[model samples]
Target: MQGENVSLHCRKKDANSSYTAKFYKNGISIGSSSSGNIMAPTVSKSDEGLYKCSIADAGESPESWLSVADLGFPQVLPNRQQFFQGEPITISCEGLNGRTGWRVMKKINGDIRICASTWETLIGSCNICNAYPSTDSGEYWCEHGEIQKSNSVNITVSGHPTVPYFKFYLVLYTGLSLLLVVILLILAGLFQHHKHQQTIRSHTKEMSLTPDDDTLYSKAIYTTLRPGETELKGHKKRAD
Candidate 1:
């Protein structure tokens, strides 16, 4: 099982002087001991591998495989059932017993995916830096091997509708500009019409004040005969 102390021993056949026993993991040298015994304390998933030891003159021992098993269930931090899009979340498989090697798994869109294999894992926990409603929303759990798995958690991600500030302001400004131009054009047309009407009225008043040709001739004749003929005309009318 995981998180357990492990010890390997190697013995030489004949009684001899002290010799250093070297330990190898997966054919690579790990450490050496003077007592012909090597100890690995609190072994985890990373410690599980092929192990062998050898003395200086003696031959190497047969390789043995180490297997680590998960201790408990998995847990999700923040422990929320609902989340918004673009939020970060973490899924941890470090159970109550402090065991490791349990992988985070999810079923999304009817397909299963393993974290750190499909996505990214940070500090031994599966991290979704930017979540999405369509892709990241699903059932999540932890699995140690093919048979052992923790309880699943249903997660729902909600997407919020957003409008671009630049585009929205651009549309608003364009509409206002067009409306302002229309208003200015209407005002200019009305002003021109008012000015034309004022000019026409001024010209008509000047024509009415001026004398015509017939009126001017009658006035001149009356002014020429006025002084002498005025009293004579009255006397002639009385005699008739």
Candidate 2:
């Protein structure tokens, strides 16, 4: 809410024992404090911009966007019906009455949420950080003392979809693994076949040695019988 005190913290970058921080808005120095927090006593439209903080010995922190909502009739800023997942949203309820007792109400996923009075400010606004598709997308409105004070705004939050290339990689991995297994099986079969061929060749060599031994015995018997026959023929010739 405008005129409400807001605090911006400067997170420390280094492991310094003590921190003296300077706050900046869009490259302009707002204030310097020892507590490392910049306090805006009364925030206005001019207070909104990219904000950061820097320490003496340390460097500057990353910039953050600061949005200030104008206190108009009770409503949601940028009254859009659709919002993406993880988007920031602001709900303001500054009606004809100026910041007396206003609360932000949201109905999401069949549950209703009522923001506390302490959560509201003179600006009658509060920030919803990182809206979720499942939890934060719903109808939101503002109320004051049991009376509906603002227009109901329905917000739709859509999450990022699954990437196509991710599934492609999954299929690719499956195919490669199957192909590798098949190739290994083929190599194993070829090795077994080679071992079987070697065993058959060894068995054939043993059979060939048996044939050679038979042939040598036949030749020896033939030579011995032929000499005996020659002796018998000589004896018959002598008897005659």
Candidate 3:
């Protein structure tokens, strides 16, 4: 009896209670008393397996066997489990059944992804932390070993597809091209206006000068600078 009280009873020839009692577990003597009975209370986890009780009477010993099973490993179920992408998951193992380790397996698009560990107790479920759709998506299961396995759980990754956003990008690119053409046309118009302004300013400044007026203007400036230079030039021309 693991984690329970135990009593060693020796069957008598006629329930006479006239014999002595002794107990042995796994072939080791545990307790014996002269009162013909033995009771062990609060049996710990270590006490398990087949036990035998013997009674010595009139120089004869008779023995009988008893089996005690303890509370051992935890339970592992398959029907109600799941897995998701980017989230690593683990499963609990039971019995001494060669856990060796546990493998978290998933059938992802007809492919398998597995992770293994040797533990009887699990701190978290098989669905790992912070699971996301694009990175971690697939059908999954918790595998114990080649000998023992659990049920399969499909991991459906839910998210929006990228195709619609790509189409939006194409639409934006076409709109940008139209905007660039309009900007170029506006710039060309502004350049034409500035060139026209420069031409008008040049034409207005040159209109103040005529061919005859240019000669009169030069004579006026020459007469003011020299008093008799023109008369001396005429005398020198006559002498020659």
Candidate closest to the true structure, highest TM-score: 1
The TM-score-based order of candidates, best leading, equals 1, 2, 3
lDDT string for model 1 (77-115, tens) is 667667778888888887535546677888999999886
lDDT of 2 by residue, 53-88 (tens): 988777888899888665444455557556667778
RMSD per model, one decimal:
13.8, 18.0, 16.0
lDDT (CA) per prediction: 0.75, 0.70, 0.53
lDDT of 1: 0.75
Report how far off residue 150 is in candidate 3 (Å).
14
Best by lDDT: 1
Candidate 1, which segments miss by more than 4 Å at Cα?
1-73, 118-123, 161-240
How high a TM-score does candidate 3 get? 0.29
Identify the superior model by lDDT, candidate 1 or candidate 2: 1
Instruction: Name every residue pair that clashes in candidate 2.
Output: 1-123
TM-score of 2: 0.32
Task: Report the number of backbone clashes for model 3.
Answer: 6
> Once model 3 is optimally superposed onto the true structure by TM-score, how far is the C-alpha of residue 172 displaced, in angstroms?
2.1
